[model samples]
Target: MENNKGKSEWVSQQNYSESQSTPYCITRRYGSLTFEETVQNVKNGIKKLGLDLVGEFDVREYLSSDMEKMPRHLILMVCEKETALKLISNDIQMSVLFPCNVTIKEVENNTIIEVSIEDTDSTWSSAKKKEIIEVAKNTKNILKKLLDTIEQQNVKL
Candidate 1:
């Protein structure tokens, strides 16, 4: 709830929440930053966290018709070197979830910055594998830091 200056910024608008699925997981954090600003801040966070930027997919780029008018959405594929190595070393099948996805999209007419992180918890949750659990926990921690970092990067309205 604190801004870069350590003061309350958009605490009223920022809603922090988490959502999950069977095999797929998502950790979402909301902010008051502009869509463009969130994208750039997230990109910086990926590198700052020492995660490799595999690529960035612009969901809006696929639009060719009226769909082009949709809200801006972008997907950033970020991979932690050590995390990946540990995962595949544990089981090759885990490669299917390689490169955690950090999605940035504008919601409510660009009034809020929605960043969703791919949480690797479910994969370890069912198997109850200690090794993978540690790695997943670490990765989730780093991703959480990334979200906070983006929030600390503030701008005055």
Candidate 2:
């Protein structure tokens, strides 16, 4: 019932004067993640990360209806930007993103982890798209560092 568009603005201004920008959600605009197992996979990933992830079947359903499709999962988590960067970079292969169901955007001081079971068919601006990809790469690197730091700390502990 509530509109959730444009919910991806960060509080702090990022240095983007010379930064390459790319529009997110470029590929599939409409699709469905009708498989229950896919949805659970997303759920498990979020939970495993210890994020306060919640299921939004209603929102998913609503959006699916409006867009004429449903994503596998819409996992919402409120974490620091640094933490988000870490999570995105955890897996080197990052195969979790292959399904084309993930949308990681900063949402009003919060990071939105949109996991779709189905693929999307939406198009975005080239600059914005480039920016999104860059963000993903950065996130992966940050996450990798975070993991290494944690592991080192654990060893000390």
> Residues 96-139, candidate 2, lDDT per residue (tens digit)?
33322333222222222222221111221122345445545544
For this target, which candidate reaches the highest lDDT against the unseen true structure?
1
TM-score for each model: 0.75, 0.28
Q: lDDT values of the candidates?
A: 0.72, 0.34
Candidate 2 lDDT for residue 145: 36
Where in model 1 is the C-alpha error above 4 Å?
A: 1-31, 64-68, 123-127, 155-157
List model 1 lDDT by residue over 54-84, tens digit each: 9888876754232434667789998977888
Task: Give the local distance difference test score of model 2.
Answer: 0.34
